[model samples]
Target: MAKRRFGRVRQLSSGRWQARYAGPDNVDRPAPQTFDRKKDAETWLVQKEAEILAGDWLDPDAGKIVFLEYARSWIEERPNLRPRTVELYDYLFRLHLKPTFGARALADIKDAHVRRWRKDLLDNGVSAVTTAKAYRLLKAIFNTAVDDLLVRRNPCRIKGAGQEKSPERPVLTVAQVYALADAIEPRFRALVLLGTFGSLRWGELTGLRRRDVDLDAGTVRVERQLIRITGQGLVFTEPKSAAGKRTVVFPELIAQDLRAHIKDFAQDGDDGLIFVGPDDGPLWNSNFNRRFWGKALTDAGLAKIHFHDLRHTGNTLAANAGASIRELMDRMGHSSTRAAMIYQHGSHERQREVADRLDSLARGQLKSGSGTQRARKPKKAE
Candidate 1:
């Protein structure tokens, strides 16, 4: 490392005098800096030397590239993402990210600027979770720029970066489930029943075909989901993930109800949609939720919950009935066990029953009166 001393200028063989500062990376790299006079070199070198020693020396050239230009390039390069996902990314960029650092060059973005942005988001009443998501998007964008050599480092690496806790969803009780079922119109009753018992999502429920239900086998095949896109509107697509394509079994009673439902309401063709509008076309999510679900829940005299809560209620009931974590995951089509565990919090009665069974097995009470304990019966028979 070059010793820190002002006015110590070196004249190269080319007769150009330049000031040099050793980088913290433990190498004597040139600063690409030039000076017209020895005094100028000394002043520049002294200020740089102090900053380097303070462990805060950053090259200013990095902060020169504007963030908006890089963000546009980033969005354009990703063509394979789903339309809904792309729309969300674009929304986050325009509403949150771009407005903050749109004009700032990539090289000029600093840790302090990122910190202030996070604070401003909180001050503006944006939820911590949304802010965190936006932060991650920004981090990903800048990290790509770093790989491309557009910037020295990502400024998003500072601590307290992302959102923390996700909001909790309320689970419904068995009585509330029945009330919700009874309150809806008879035409949409099966929809509520399938959602509550089978744990089908809104898209999955609306995407069902007559052939997907096997009444004798008591199973429903989940093959596709309805997705609402911004520009193209509603379309049926394959399940979001492989795990989402699954078979769910229901009780024989529910299966019987489904059979009757088809015989009376559903069309004869196998390709006919199981749940459709009065004109036999695809069901619109907004119209169904507004006309059927909202009024049903209100009449049931229960808390206002979204249609998606029916799926949660199903998972909760299964968990309370002693369903294993893996079984619940498979039924819910959850790609991971983490979310399924949240719905597995059952009542104290179930927990106590499990504890008592475990205690009996551990204490050898199960073998106390077995056939091996027979006494004198063989002698009497002889």
Candidate 2:
């Protein structure tokens, strides 16, 4: 056979065309199957050469691994992933990704399949936010696969499909915050107040120690959080990011409430838990929400508002108090300004005040102009 430019296409003894080429590793590998036509074999060699040139060539057999196995390994081998994050990935895989792509080979999954799966999820009443999460996880998994040369290209190509559209929650006024604080139990009044004023998350609030709260300094040092993992009770771990470990100063209002809470409810020693159950043991979010939070909401007449919204309320209040973007990010324990921007947006009342001020300015200018014209009038030219 004549020497070809990229690879040789030779006729096998069985009368089929076979393509062979030396891969990037300098290994001589042949086509998996023989082509009936010489042109088809030549085209296959052309693609192989193009892949090699582009540094995207992967062994055909490498991507044959089942997606379920590969995805599980990916999640397990992720470095520095938190326990809660790992749990969420596992759940999302099992509930959303596994059933659709579990048995399929990694290479066989394509953009069309992803689009179909997302459509089916929405058709079956799955929330868009949840579907977005699953899509993002799948994208991450495939991204790893691409990096490992297990797949040539990622299939998650739907634009904006991986971005979650979360609905804005209601931000409580300062008065409403106090109302909820008064409605909750004495021991938990500080929880409501801090969640709104200090912008502390549930895990941070539950994880606080007496030593972490400095009444003298009027600041709380957030260092750790209490996260509940499945098959494990509650584990205290450092905050997820370096930015999460912050020192947030509380106003005198929050300080006074904290003092009362410490005197009436917090544990005795500095090492003791600050927020606990009725028995002074560590409080769980589930227990608080089920046993206490729901009743407090009803009593405060703020039904349908989630407890997490209290943190949002606090961030909004801080923004209203002229907290800058960086200050909001620091106070909210967020590593990025994206979340801070969301919290720093103008309130409806603030927007209304702007319009009201503009109207007053326009009316004042009109009255001044009319008076000047009247004063300039010369007795009807008499």
Candidate 3:
């Protein structure tokens, strides 16, 4: 029968105290269980008020949203995700997150559930890398759900679960690079050459146009990348970052090969496709690997080498050629910059100078024909 400062408490006919308060949503919320005494009811009201004042109070019913529905909406709402990124997220959700958490409400999901899901993925023979990707996607989705007030907190609290610990890729020697190039079909020889010497990504290679490559300048411009979506065959998209829209100077020594590639393989016109499949269609990674890359690796006598490793080898060659990290970032089209590097992109001339050094290094490595530098062991107890 008495009015409390925070909430009004009423003594029911059953001699129990019922406490009710107006929530931030302007709707009255009653305590789930009534208290036996006035003091207890008052204490409940005080705690609720404290939670509201501390900005830690959750809307009681907001988290009733289903995880699947919320996640779908989240993907739709994200404007900045690339098509390939959207495809990847969709794949992860379908394969990993959906079966376990899709039907559950946002509030019902907990950290324990997340841990169990991740463990199940690993137990079922999912690669650690794939599991980490799934965990990161789940964490990102829950993060947005929290911000949108759909959940009180993100349930992805496991430490380092989202971090990927993939094994280091093998880097090929200069001679091996040339061998792989020669072993591949003649048209694709330049593809492998540019992939290494120009440090171009697969998408960048597939997306190349006649105009993108400047043989006279000894440079290749990254205007866009060709990405393949599940339902969609191929789509050309602009670089995601300003850094990706860059000019990467390749060694002049490789220009003759490039010139021949363009004359023989590239489609007509300045805007014509530079590197097309035998059918003149944009190169599909799977098809290329099966039809060309796999056999080339066999012929070159290299094992466990990835196509992307070409770029890695180029990066290493550049570093060994005395290229600064900033220069590497510039050539690699890395959007994220290191603190010491400060995103200071080198001038075209500076890049060309680095390219020249790369040329010298490649020549030396080709002459030496060493795949790996073997470290000398010290004599024991001499």
Candidate 4:
């Protein structure tokens, strides 16, 4: 076989040519693949020589590190991630990413591998929302790998694979919200009302303290949130974003109930938890869902719903009440306007607008009606 200045090629027993060269680090490296012809092998060596001379060569052996090790280190190296976010990353790695890619080398992961893994997850009935989160995580890990030069390019190139097409969450009407609040145990009535009208997240509402709430002023300060992370149990942490730290001025309609809750259920100290379970401890979601939420759904004749839907309902109410995008973002504690836009630009509400206009066009032919209606049951709470 012929020799080259950059690399050498030798014919294999099967008549294929293998290329070997000294990399810029002076380490002898082999071409990743054997070539069908000596010329092909020499061509690869030439390209590697050019890359080395141009300072664009990446050490192939670096990518031999297993994906699991790199991914774990990636999560660990990140600074200032919320504990719940770290927990979620761990969860996704364990359940979704680890099973398929953990043992594989970073260099071995390909776009096809990601596509097949995503397809298998969907086929196995894993939720799209969950799959999307996992996919995004995988993509992010690979992104860092590219930046670190572990791999030449990101393997996660599927378009729209990272976007979650979450179903529209159910929102409770004012009457329904009030009925559900009343149907729950008396101690949690104010908790439920605050969740709806104030758009308080589960973590924020459960983490409230006597010092954080001013019943007379009808404002609740959101300085912190309580999150339950696996292994660590309940942890009190700052809000997810800076916008989450803002205070909310709630409707005066619920002031009476707030005072009653404070008097009947709250502790005297400033640091006292605003909401608690029967054990008079930190309010746990599992206990509340099993003991209160399930029963409240039955008594109020409402269908199954997640607790976060209360915040969803509150956001919708605020949007219907003409809250601006910034106002909604502040109330919902969102870092961006994308989530707020979902509530403001709902297709169902737009369809109603079209129907109402069409109804007006036909008003001459039909009898006049009550026009529009709004629920007024929240004020009726005893």
Candidate with top TM-score is: 4
What is the lDDT of every predicted structure here?
0.81, 0.90, 0.87, 0.90
TM-score of 2: 0.87
Between candidates 2 and 3, which one is better according to TM-score?
A: 2
User: lDDT for model 3, on a 0 to 1 scale?
Assistant: 0.87
> Which is the winner by TM-score between candidate 1 and candidate 2?
2
Per-residue alpha-carbon lDDT of candidate 4 for residues 43-140, written as tens digits (9 for 90 to 100): 89888889988888899999999999999999999999988889899999999999999999999999899999999999999999999999999999
Model 2's alpha-carbon lDDT is: 0.90
> 355 in model 4: Cα distance from truth in Å?
8.8
Better of 3 and 4 by lDDT: 4
Model 3: which residue pairs collide?
Answer: none
User: What stretches of model 3 exceed 4 Å from their correct place?
Assistant: 8-19, 32-41, 53-55, 338-382
lDDT of 2 by residue, 1-382 (tens): 5668787888999999999998887788899899999999999999989988987789877899999999999999999999999989999999999999999999999999999999999999999999999999999999999999999899999999999998878888888888998898888988999888889999999999999999989999999999899989899999989999999999987788898888888888988888899988889888888999899889989867888899998888888777899999899888999989986567888778778989887778777785343334355754
The residue ranges of model 2 lying beyond 4 angstroms of the native Cα positions read 1-37, 354-382
**Model 4 spans with C-alpha error above 4 angstroms:** 1-3, 12-14, 346-382
Instruction: Identify the runs in model 1 with alpha carbons over 4 angstroms from their true place.
Output: 1-64, 158-164, 359-382
Q: Give the per-residue Cα lDDT of candidate 1 at 167.
A: 72
Clashes of each: 9, 0, 0, 0
Residue pairs with colliding backbones in model 2 are: none
Best by lDDT: 4
Clashing pairs in 4: none
